[model samples]
Target: MKRKSLIITLLILGSILFANGWDVQEYPYDLYVYYIVTKAPEKYENLIGSSVVAVTSHRHGDFGNAFNSSCKSGVIEFLENEDFVIDKMDGIDSTFLSKSFIEKYFPEVLCADISVSKEDLSYIWENLSSKYVGFSDMKKRGLNKKKFNKIKNTSELKALFDKYMEDCHFDMKIREFTYYQETAYDEGCKKSKDQRDIYFEQETSNAYYVRFTSCVEANANYFTNLEAVGVIGRNKEFIILDARSNYGGSNYVQEKLQKILNLEKYKGTVIVLQDNWSTSSGEVWSIFGNEKSQFKTLLVGTHSGGMQNYDRSNTIKNDDLNIEISFGSKYLGKILPKNYLGEGKGYEPDIWATTETMASVLTGLGVDVTGITFQ
Candidate 1:
């Protein structure tokens, strides 16, 4: 009889604990809640309870998993009255709090103020003539800068920008204004590897192929690799520069490549290959080679990635959340051509061909590929 009574009592206690499970509070949960309430109160005031679930269930990155695992689990609970109650404590290390983790799990919270504002429109309008290179072109398309004053949000602003881009056939990938969000892991947790800047292959006696995987100046071999291409391909009748899948880096690297290749003095035809993955500075370099080169140049493959309008980025940090929001600060409008592509629209190729069909395509274009191989 006594054993039965004890079992019943334990069952009641277990039920109570389970019922009050969400009523518990911990430091990490408190910090998360505090950040949401303080930084983005208007956006998250109603969704605080749901955000707690998201934070707890988040398992995509290293920091999230470490902080939320059972080994480091602290009692967490949200109340209807907006009260945080603590029943147990298991502290999480502050080192695990990272900007990448917050960005991945809580993008809305991080970018709450990303919506377009009246001030933003006013500033763009005021600087349109002097700062925006596309100003005259956009106006020629019947897009009045004043119309932007009616934009209520980011979506509306983006729609207006998209319309202008489509009408002008500009690079739709370059935005007149943009918010940049970087979700990469912090430097401490990132893995390092040795990577080559460029790869060269002699396809035939008359033809050579050079693939630029990266144009980052940070790479110690960047200049050396470009110099090697200039030396090796100087005598080739046909030079194929493949920039497919290259993410791009510094503008100076592209400038260095241009100087090294010295296309103005070259006698051979230069074919610059690009795909949708060839983005930022890579796309710029490809476009320059095709449009600005002194020698005959052909841009092959699909459209190049078009995120090249913004030249610089600025960051705003939330110290409490330990998160940084990066935004495009410098617009490239002043220097880019009037017909330059917009954000989201990449550069169109002169010859459309994939890696598999490149050999056939070149042959069709009257280029001899009898002994040449495609990779």
Candidate 2:
């Protein structure tokens, strides 16, 4: 019995020395929680009681099979109060707290997903290093300082992401794909492509309408559809870039569209129609039209969904535990205005109008919008 115990002890020590042991240190959720607390302690200090405290308590302990099981239980307990934790969140282990932040605080403005591979790190690195406007206010929005400090450049960030990928896991929870979400995305794409008025069309001598949806410009259909909007904006007296249902994508859409439309020379009064659905680049375009457009511009609608910043994310999956950790490294807001505070609060519209009353409101502004509809 004594010889057998000695052999087991040596095996455990060897596993630890080789860094191949599945201990508390390797538990993605525990490490992630530790990263958040250590990195953004002040931001999340007050929200302590459940798994936040539990995970943070054992940051340095050896994580074996027993520890992982207990840690998962603790995390689930902490996530019980979060509004969006559907079905006990059995699949999630490390992303509970940040995911809560996404669902509760920045639901419309930001997106993060569980990834089990390192294939997308290069793309993530590119976005993180891009130019942003408001660089100082990142901490207020929960940017992890510890992780940010380690990644000073693109190469460093890539290396850090690679480090997280050392442990491979097949997260059953994350692997449980929801077909409904994909179906919705497909439907939205179809609707945006099929919508005819995204390109500018003359409805009257002084009034023009463009019911635009999405800023995802790679689609050939969108490029083909919106070409006419540029043709009319140069000579039209009034232009309406409708963005009531915009959800956002690349800013290239704005850059390309403005160039194609010759918006700088357009002498018309351009009015942007936005609402809560207008997010990310949608909000950016509205702000651009209102403050930077060469033509006279007016933004009409309710508060716009303000998710103008860019996010850098890392996804870690532990196949042994069947869990995944999707976390953000940085939140770059360089494109936003210097003093912009419209992240969660959204951007207040100059003329507050809902979908029902938008057409009437447009008509009142000397825009003979007889058949124009807002989406």
Candidate 3:
């Protein structure tokens, strides 16, 4: 009996060591969570209204490879009240990271903990060496510091706070200086100025025009910006609503705009050019407006991008670096399903406006585009 007890004790110790087994003395207890933000029920009225957060990092690891702290409890508690969701979040065990599907969507939030006597940074440095570029990367980033301060606004960062933390002046980690938000990268992916101009001018210019490329969210920006510009009568005097590139964006923005549009300035007729590319929020906007707008909705292009539902996301937990990790996304309901002229089935346009038709429409004067195509 005594021998068995000793064996069990050894096994427990072995498990702990093996789970986060590394020669380095300390490493943070990592946690990961990914979710999407669908609605802003008055509580979350700040951050960029409803958006999808896609957690893009994963490693083939077991579930509880590093659960040695109360961090998991802290995180779960934090996310309990937010407008976010976990795809399959259960308890701490299920909620934590391992070599599972969870990792596929979310990365293990790494906390680069390095207390004075704790000696965790060294261990973390060694453990993450393979993941990062080099140990110099850790050294340069002051990973050895117990706590690092970060200022969100650059002006704020420039206005240095005299107060100092334990690791304030620690050796600077070069090349490791970067804000943890998705700024330039995401913005770059948005539609270019030229593209927006063309779409705006052609669509709203009282003439017939079509959009070449578009994303659901980005296209939402395009449409809204175009309306703003149209209010000033700067670009397209009339817009050809071609959602061929629109997949969709914020639900509220689309719905609210429809109501506002029906009021004035355009109580007559409008031509909408679309195709199969219209998706997500784009399809919803197209369907709702066309079906219930005061203007004569003439769909000349194909059906819009077939978008049934939208996936919501958010960050429930972040790494030691204060970089949060997102959990699974909460899939939202379809704002418009049947409205998808060519989601999966096929897109059918009113005038069957194609490449040739578009050219001809642009050349001819704005009169009657009826029977323009041979059905």
Please report how far candidate 2 places residue 66 from its true position, in Å. 31
What TM-score, to 2 decimals, does candidate 1 have?
Answer: 0.48
lDDT of 3 by residue, 1-375 (tens): 999999999999987645432111123434533222222223333321222222221110112323333243333233333312222222111122222222332233321222222222333233334332223333564544333233333233222211221111111211222112110111111111122212333333243333423443535555555444324322333545445434344445444545555655454445555444344444444444446666555556544433343232433222444322221133333334344432242234556545435646534536333323211
Give one digit per residue, the lDDT tens place, for model 1 in 1-375.
999999999999998655543332223452333222111123223333322222211111112322322211221312322222111112311112233344544555433333556655665556544544555666777788668788876667666765653211122111222323221121222111112354445566677766665677644455566556666777778777767655666656556555656743778877877765566666654345544556667788766656666643443443443333333445554555444455555676778776667789877766666654454
Q: In terms of TM-score, how similar is model 2 to the real structure?
A: 0.46
Which tens-of-lDDT digit does each residue in 89-149 have in candidate 2?
Answer: 1222222232333333333322224343333333332333342222223334544435555
lDDT of candidates 1 onward, in order: 0.49, 0.44, 0.35
Candidate number of the best TM-score:
1
Q: Lowest-lDDT window of 10 residues in candidate 1?
A: 85-94
Candidate 2: list runs displaced more than 4 Å: 1-202, 217-219, 260-264, 284-287, 290-292, 311-316, 321-332
Better of 1 and 2 by TM-score: 1
Clashes of each: 16, 11, 41
Q: Candidates' TM-scores?
A: 0.48, 0.46, 0.34
After superposing candidate 1, which stretches have Cα over 4 Å from the reference? 1-198, 217-219, 260-264, 284-287, 290-292, 319-324, 329-331, 337-339, 366-375
Candidate 3: RMSD to truth: 22.7
True-vs-predicted CA distance for residue 375, candidate 2, Å: 5.2
